[model samples]
Target: MFKVCGYTCNRNDFLKKHMRLHSGERHYKCEVCGYACNQKCDFKRHMRTHSGERRYMCKICGKEFTGSDQLMKHLRIHTEERPYTCKVCGKSFYQSAHLKQHIKMHSGERPYMCEVCGKAFKRSGILKTHMRIHTGERPYECDVCGKAFKRSGILKTHMRIHTGERQYKCDVCGKTFISSCYLKTHMRIHTGDIPYKCDVCGKAFISSGDLKAHIRIHTGERPYKCDVCGKAFTQNSTLKAHTRIHTRESPFTCEVCGCACKQRGTLKKLMRLHTRERLYKCEVCGYALNQSGDLIDDMKTHSEEGLFMCGVYGKTFKQSGNLKKHMRTHTRERPYMCGVCGKAFPKSCNLKTHMRIHTGERPYKCEVCGFACNQSGSLKKHMVLHKGERPFKCEVCGYACYQSDELTDHMRSHAKEKLCEVCGKEFKLKGNLKTHMRIHTGEKPYKCDVCGYKCNQNGTMKIHMRLHTGERPYKCEVCGEAFKQSGNLTEHTKTHTEERPYMCEVCGHAFRQSCNLKTHMRIHTGERPYNCEVCSKAFAESQTLKAHMRIHTGDGPNKSEVRGYACKQSSDIQGRNRTNVTFAMKHSNMIPGSNT
Candidate 1:
């Protein structure tokens, strides 16, 4: 207790400090800064400015405080130590003055009354700031912007724009804030400390301002009302955003491209394109994306929720975009047409890749080997071979693959029970069965324009045209090997592995491929597939018939036509009458293995 002007006090030290108001004494002083104060406590607090000493500490939060009052206030948050209680309402508070204010609320007491307007306020600080409105007093001014504010705090906050200073920092997330109040508000997100409670639904909030706004929902109070449309909103920001519709004001603009947008988020997303900023990332595959929409689109690829399924192959996709792209395989729909050759592709990206054929553009280049590809994905997959990196692993088996499609294709090998109903033949994929059915139906959909030769498969037709054009696209890196198609490269790699996967069922003979086994099976079946058009003689094999043709053409190794044994046997076989016995003799001057 302290006393002044003939009032009694408990301690002489307190009386000495209390007399400073009348005596105007400056007894205690700082040694380093030469600053003086009337009381010892004030001088000691000022000395801390030079000493950088924080004596008080909070035990629960491990936060150090320079003053005992600050430590006491912070302790209430953890301990909920409210000592002051209102007598009228029996409400507890952390501070005695807050309890006094609570008692005034029940009594409807406003002791601080304005002299001019007779209006009242509870707090002296509020009344002082409010009196500035009538007095037109803006004492605080900014040094940088020359802006006047009612209080020094507002002036300090405004100075942050020029100074770029953030004094308060979040301890949890390391994010800095310009003001202590904003930092306090942000701490609630990490602490989940809701101090303000709504009386309507018992919903809690971290701030009193938020609780007041939430109460408007229950009361149906629209304080911020629109003038033009006669619409009401609880928040001022919502009203301001809604007014943009009537005003047609696009405030957010891109600095890079001069594009304007209504929302700030849209402008921010557009700016990322010029900056090439990839903020949002995929967790599953570490794929980086610029916008949240792009992240959402990429996340669907990793999801197991197959909303769309292919009817022909039974392949599933998580997104509708992927399923739509896959449907083009069955429909053979090539909507994206090339401008150079008028060749159509199923996807726009595929068309972009096709345009590179004419442009001779291979943008994606390998860093290790300098192998360039038109698509970026091809370059990424090709790099894995150099590193021997197989990231995609099968869950059923321990098999690994370089790409996601390789993993999908490998899964079919584990589930090999799927069979073709037409031929009762087993196939790893349903698409293989559909392709095999083409052989039975003799559906030569693919036709060649040069020689009018038709094939059941499009891939076979591409290989067939390579015979005429002499085009070999696939090349091996280990060996100087080149092939007309990718399947040839695959088969050529097996030479290095020495893997014999195919076997004959009749005999225990093993081969490197199924096609070789099919050729060997013809020996047991005695199936003569090749026939000579000149004499209608069926041969057991194409190579044998080609060799025997030399005897009829007088181009045989014997050179005497082997006494024309080939043509005489062909004419006598099957009891068929020859159109001309001298037909073989007339064609003796003809060349062997010639198109003519």
Candidate 2:
């Protein structure tokens, strides 16, 4: 027997080989691959990596491994087997070295100590790396450039930029990487295998490292911190990118416009302006978008889920940006400023339309009539004349409308009601009920700052502002006429076309305006809405109230007074207006208090 250090071997050659382990000698060499080992067993294990030989197999999962040690380690995952237990702490581990590391914590035994920071570590390699941090010593330097790295592995990875040596390649995607671990992680994307899952969110990740990173989001933990600014980030890469702002380093440059950016992502985004590349596409609509965010926005048309909601109207929106734009409709926020003219708009699209007047740019054109317009909305409206398209149809009432807004307004009549507590009136919509309650409550919330004019509705206040401002915004291109209200302009346009949509059921007479038709209905119904407070007499029209009130004011004659001086006063009545003449004739006495 041959014995060296508390170990005996059967043969002298075996003892010599065991001595090589302590001596760090690699005598055994493989001719096929450039692999050398201190012992024959290690050389045989290394050979299996090149030979595609996997002899050991897991009994539970039938997973093959090149070595028995590799298979034995993998079985712990299925069996939950931990054989090695720490005698001091009773902390169990699958490997004996892990148990040895755990026992060191209780013993307070640190073999490796940093000279610079006075920090102690269990391993010599970790202590050596810690010393380099205080010294700022990057020993591994690049061959092409003077760029240095702290570790040899980091230097090897950096050299891939110069050499373009992708040692590991993905079998599925053909994606290349410098390391085997990165290739293993890339394989999960093809396999759709997520081993680690978040307990809170149930979001699965490829690796335990990524799972740990995601858990920080739930824990509100930001371990990676910026030393320069003291700002914390979820990711180390984000902190690295943020450091460039403080340094004023724009490393990434746009090749097309020579524009410099702090990050490569910003440069790629800038390049899209020249490339016009729309990579993302909507699955439902086939609408191509330049960015993934825009694709998410466009996909909202298909989804019923609206994450963002309006506080005022209770209207839901898919994206926060759409919700922000919708809130502007309530707040009347006009942030978009016109540079050419000092004008602001509630929306950017509205500002864009206003710019066309200054630029004389009419991009939108009617396909049927070839009528060019500044806005696409105008072009769409113009198309209705040619096609008579009424796409917006009321579900309850068989009525169709050209505009979606008209249909939305028409749908209000069909909606379920909410009762007003003050008036006991049922309003189809909650907003209308709120307004109706305000009328009874005498709450005139919409008040004019200029004239102190108060109104119950916001629309009335808007219309009243035009009186003070003298702003005629809506203009007719046909007759060169303009109006303060858009509704007035819409009615005026109908007169030119001679289109009378509203009709009287009694006389078969048609009117261009719906309000005119409603007034005409009052004649047949004889509904006396206006009542005099003094006389207690009701009239069909409000104009009739003025004529009736003239009796008490000595402006007109009573029936008894008129008949006393009939012929002489009647001639005086003929000189008066038609209203006074009708009053005079209605009275049998057209004499007294009827003097000219």
Candidate 3:
């Protein structure tokens, strides 16, 4: 046995070679490259590079190397045999040199230091790569795209783009990635491994890039900026998305509806409309949203205090934007206007939705019935029909509705009615009184593009357009019957329940709808509001007046059917020729209870 400097060897030649390190002597030297080594084998291996001789070859991959040890290390990659491992972390390495470098990480020793940035690395190659940042040197270049990278590994990964290759695959999800680093980062999603942590906040992130971005939030540092708007962002991706607004460039487009969006995140949110994917959910209300930002906004509804209050109505709102929008109602201000139709809206989102009418764009769709709509709220409300989920319920009437706004409107019915001073009419809502006043003013603001039909309310115009489009959005859950208007559906649904809420006071007669009871009251009161233009004959019911019109129009019922029908009153027709008189009543196209 031979030993020197606490190192021992069995062979005398190995001991003599080990002694050269203490003596500071290198016997074997390369004259061509000026490389020197104490070991004869290492010196011969270095000399092989000059001669272009790679004697050692891998059996599996046919890769050539100058030495046998180099070939052995290369073979481990194919075999996935990591012989060398660190004691501290138990991390295995293919080569002993890698294990040595990994041990330096455990020791907190970064020997290879960059002089320019004073940054340290465990390995010399990593330090060399770091130095390129200061020098702006990208040594490795791609042959296809001519893109340069600081490291050969990055250049190799970049080449995969041109090659259309995704070599690394996730074992769990089978998702492919270009590089092993990307695969490693993706594995964290399955593993739930948040290794990168912020020292200040103790918040952990899946990747180092996320951790770096999160750290900028604490520092209030926005490195990325838009040239057009001068708006700053924490992320470069956000800045690129912001730049598209100035360019009016919508790069991401929906494959299903062809709706173009400026940002990828916006496109993703739009895709959720087609997919019906609601990932982020509100814990308080169980309301789910596609995007995290929307979920965050919804969460505020539960916990947020009424910080902003309206001066005119004394209404309190959680957000300042809500307060601003509420003020528009009181002022009757429609600030947002459509470019195509010159239609004005109180909110910008309302204007955006109105533009879809001209564009004929309906992005939101129901998965069950193939019902499509321009608005997300419409799709959400439409989904309730299939699910039969009435989340919002009125306490007073026990009326269940899909939307909170519907429940709010129903609750107002129990409250004191808003009075119209001009006509002495009572309304459940203040908006109802305003709409009723339009009848007196003869102002019809909302007009249908399909037809020349006009109405005072926008909602009424929308329902009227359904006559042309044949869009029956409101459906009866009991009978599977559809109606163009929601009020018609509500009235139809009462037939299934056989629940008569409205009643006639005089005869104790019950009616399914309140409008039916109102028409019944006119019979006992002896009021004949509907009058004929030809003979000046008046009738209590609109149907009776409509039947009376057949006398002049020559489209009257058969003479034999109405022979005994000397109808003195509207109820008198019920006893005489009920079938023939009902036929004349149904045929009338004129407005009900109006002078025809």
TM-score ranking, best first: 3, 2, 1
Residue 507, candidate 2: Cα error in Å is 2.4
lDDT of 3 by residue, 1-596 (tens): 43445787788888888888889899988999798999888999998988999999888888899999889789889999999988998999998898998899879998988998788889888887888888999988999979898988888889997898999998865768899999999777556477998999676778889899989989999999888778899998888877886787998899998877888668878888899987665667889777654754565566645256799977777667889999999999999988876889999988888988889889788878999999998898889989989999887778899888888888988999998888899999898899999999999999877778889998888778888988998888877989998888888888888989999999999998888898889889987889999999888778778777876776634333444544444554565566866666666654485435
Local distance difference test scores for all models:
0.80, 0.80, 0.83
lDDT value, candidate 3, whole model: 0.83
Off by over 4 Å in 3: 1-57, 62-72, 79-92, 141-147, 191-203, 249-429, 432-596
Error of 2 at 311 (Å): 20
Backbone Cα, N, C clashes tallied per candidate: 0, 5, 0
Model 1 earns a TM-score of 0.35
Clashing pairs in model 2? 562-589, 562-590, 562-591, 563-589, 563-590
lDDT of 1 by residue, 81-167 (tens): 888887777788998878887787888888898777888998787789888978999998887778899988889887886788998
Which candidate has the top score in lDDT? 3
For candidate 2, the 10 contiguous residues with the lowest summed lDDT are 560-569
Q: What is the C-alpha RMSD of each candidate to the true structure, in Å?
A: 19.1, 18.5, 16.4
lDDT of 2: 0.80
Q: TM-score per candidate, in order? A: 0.35, 0.35, 0.44
